[model samples]
Target chain A: MLQQLSAQELPKVEQEMTDFITQYTTQEDLKKSMLYSIEAGGKRIRPLIVLATVQAFQKTLNAPVYQTAGALEMIHTYSLIHDDLPAMDDDDLRRGKPTNHKVFGEALAILAGDGLLTGAFQLISETTLEPTENVLLIQLLAKAAGIGGMVAGQAGDMAAEHQQVSLGELKAIHRGKTGALLTYAFVAGGILAQQPAYVLTLLEKLGGHIGLAFQIRDDLLDVVGTTEALGKQVGQDEKSAKSTYPALLSVAGAKDALEQELAQAQATIEQLTKAAGFQPQVFQELLALFTL
Target chain B: MLQQLSAQELPKVEQEMTDFITQYTTQEDLKKSMLYSIEAGGKRIRPLIVLATVQAFQKTLNAPVYQTAGALEMIHTYSLIHDDLPAMDDDDLRRGKPTNHKVFGEALAILAGDGLLTGAFQLISETTLEPTENVLLIQLLAKAAGIGGMVAGQAGDMAAEHQQVSLGELKAIHRGKTGALLTYAFVAGGILAQQPAYVLTLLEKLGGHIGLAFQIRDDLLDVVGTTEALGKQVGQDEKSAKSTYPALLSVAGAKDALEQELAQAQATIEQLTKAAGFQPQVFQELLALFTL
Candidate 1:
């Protein structure tokens, strides 16, 4: 269910992003810089989650939902661009492509990230979503992507570098760095579907569990996956002395944590199915994406 | 009148910013970094314009308006923080104090700017205004500050550095770099007052003229003002071969241009006064802010 829905909706999501960037960005150079990152392409997991959550509701998918998904992708992309900047990760490669700064130079790269982040909000505002929905979406996106979420998470991550951190602290970092925006995708989908408040809460918890599972998988991948498969360096956490679930819990223990999160997520899906009319199959399929 | 209103209302704007940041920012270090830039004061001209514009219509000044004003200042502050980055302007001092990057290091500084920019939208979202008003404000802000406006302007400015540019080209750069967000102040004001579409149009024009005037004055100050008064080095534009109003048009020419723009702004104010029941005295005083 998730596969078919993603194949169908992801292209629409990509089109909206492309069209939005082309129509709004005026300068050729800036346009190229922005399009470079947007097109650089990842699995587009955040947008996929958004589309999947919306699809699970069985609502007639529409432009506003696509725009929201695109906006989410933009935020995710901008974070990646900044994350790779010399001042931060200092990474020269993103998904085997030269990082944005490597191609556009640092100034344009920073501006590109700034443009994408700001444009995400613009994209949402331009959506034909009801004003109330638009406002709520913008507010939630800002909160998730802003200091309360990603920024704070990043700060904490940077601070924790070169030092050992406990499991609770590690969870706090992942919650903001990955969880906040990831959770936003589900909550945004629920809002678009106009689900009840309780369903939104359930979706939030489900997103949280999935976020932890996703991070643990990522940490596991870094340790066990080959560099080529990851499309970037593996074991970077060890090189940078960055803390991760596997680092703190050991690889076997980390696998247990991942299973625990997935189990909790499955239970949440059951609740969502009962309360919000969600189809469990789609969520189950989506959950498998987190598993090894 | 502008002075009295600014004196009375500017602190309220400051308080709103402080309160909002304190309430929302979760991490201690992140909060400190965010507040440092906000507290390193400048003229507060943008928020003053917002407040003054709203007051011109005799509308009740409410929390939404203050939130809107506070959001404007946050956007402005974030721009300054990013502008001073080593990747951008590379300034070490802002308002006679160490820049955010200088004090907090580059990674945290970048995140601070990101948080502030995103927080601006969240601040507006939390406002008590009608959802339609909130949506309009967000749309206008994202356009004025995003790739289409300030980001594009900064990109053009960087591209044009150390190169001769036509007056038309220089104006184009300023339109994005400074004019867009400045113009947003007036347009947002008109939106909040529930003015007619035509009134909003007139306010946009008024803002455009004022923006040009402000940029010219800044250029003139760069050429002539003391380091003590400006709180930073002067003549840095010429050192960088930055194409400014003075550089492109000669000092006297730039002064004439400033006067011309101010006259046009006054004319716009007259039209606004007639069309939207705006009081000209408030606008006239606001216009004076652009004069040297």
Candidate 2:
């Protein structure tokens, strides 16, 4: 089932993204760089969430929502590209391949990232999604990426680098940076389906909790997972003096928090699945991905 | 009359922009940095063009055009903030003040730039403009800023840095980077006023010619103007090995090209003025600003 879903659904998402990127890139080098960052191997978790949420709510994958999913992934990929720049995180590897800045040079990499970032907005504004929903998506995505969200999280991350941060401060940081995008993914999917505003708000809170849990798990993996397993450098957080759940909380304490967040997220979605033929299988599988 | 325009119109524009920036900033340091970049000053040429174009067509500033003028200035300011970054142009000075990166450090400068860019879109989408006009403005602004336009020009600028670029190549670069915004300014003004499509197209073309002429004149000024007059480091283009009109075409050749572009632009507005009661003096004064 995992293989089938990954092969079919994931490629559709990838192709949609490729098509969008092609619209903006003409230069062979720029196209190459954009592809390098975008096609670098990683599970398309964010896109999957979008597809799953839309699927869970209704049968049809609305065309505009599909574009939003692709655009969100582009924003995610752009962030990764910039994060690996020499001036930023300075990582030479991502998904076991040369990082964007490493492959494309710092200048092109910067432009590629900017291209992807603005391109997200371009995709959003150009979509034929219902105007009200379109407006809502733009507002939600802007807040996610702007102040009090992902970009702000990045600012805080950069500012707090090497500083002694409390557990609370670390959670706030993670919530802003990582959680912001995850929250946006869910809210955007919900908004596109014309889900109730209350339900959308609940999903945002749920996604935020899961996002925090997801990052903590990664931090734990970085501390313990082998380079081969993680597909990149391990213990990078330790090297950079960045605070993480593993660093701030005991391993068991971090695990407890993760489990608690998983329960909360599951609980929030439980009522929404009360209808006929509602399969909890996908929900269970998603929870397991982070829980494991 | 020029002093009155500067004293009255320019200050009002400055205050409006200052108010916009003040909302997103609370940190004294960040405020100082943002204000330094914003207030360090330019001719407010783009916003002025937006206002002048609207007045020429509608005889008064409608709500949509008024808000859009501010938004255009925001977009223009965002480009400057990003352009002056260490990784981009590496300029430490702009408009007689420290560039954003110089004052805020590179990371905050990047965030500031992102904030400004995203904020421009937010301002436009949420405007009290007519819904149809709001939609058109969003579309126009996005196209101007995205892949084929302003940012594309920046990409070309980066690509051509340190290379032997021809006059045609330089014109293409400036057209995308500089001309795109100027074109958008005039077109946006025209759209907000519900001007006919033919008039809008003419304004776009006219704006492009002026944009190219503006760039050529900038090259001329860089070589001859005082730092006090230019309000930034002059002759830095030579230091950076950038190809300018004068560098590629000789001062005399560049001068001839500027005159030709000016004539073409004047011809466009002349037709517009003949068909409608559009004020030609607005653009006439602007032509004098650059030419005289």
Worst-scoring 10-residue span by lDDT in model 2 chain B: B24-33
Residue B14 in model 2: lDDT: 68
Best by DockQ: 1
User: Residue B201 in model 2: shift from native, Å?
Assistant: 1.0
lDDT of 2 by residue, B1-292 (tens): 3434456665666666677667654234445556667776787888888877877774666555556877788778878887877778777777667788877787677666666666666667766765556656776787787666777778788888789987778888898789989999889878866788999989999898889889989998887678887666689778778899878878888888889989998899888885466877777877787782
Model 1 residue pairs with clashes: none
Positional deviation of residue A124's Cα in model 2 after best superposition, in angstroms: 1.5
Model 1 native-contact share: 0.79
- Residue B6, candidate 1: alpha-carbon lDDT: 76
Per-residue lDDT tens digits for candidate 1, residues B1-292, read 7988778888888999999899988777889999999998898988988989988998878888888999999999999999999999898888889999999999999999999999999999999889998999999999999988998998998889889999999999999999999999999999988999999999999999999999999999999999898777899889888888898789999999999999999888878767646788899878777899
Fnat for the candidates in order: 0.79, 0.26
Model 2 regions more than 4 Å off: A1-5, A26-28, A274-281, B1-35, B59-66, B274-277
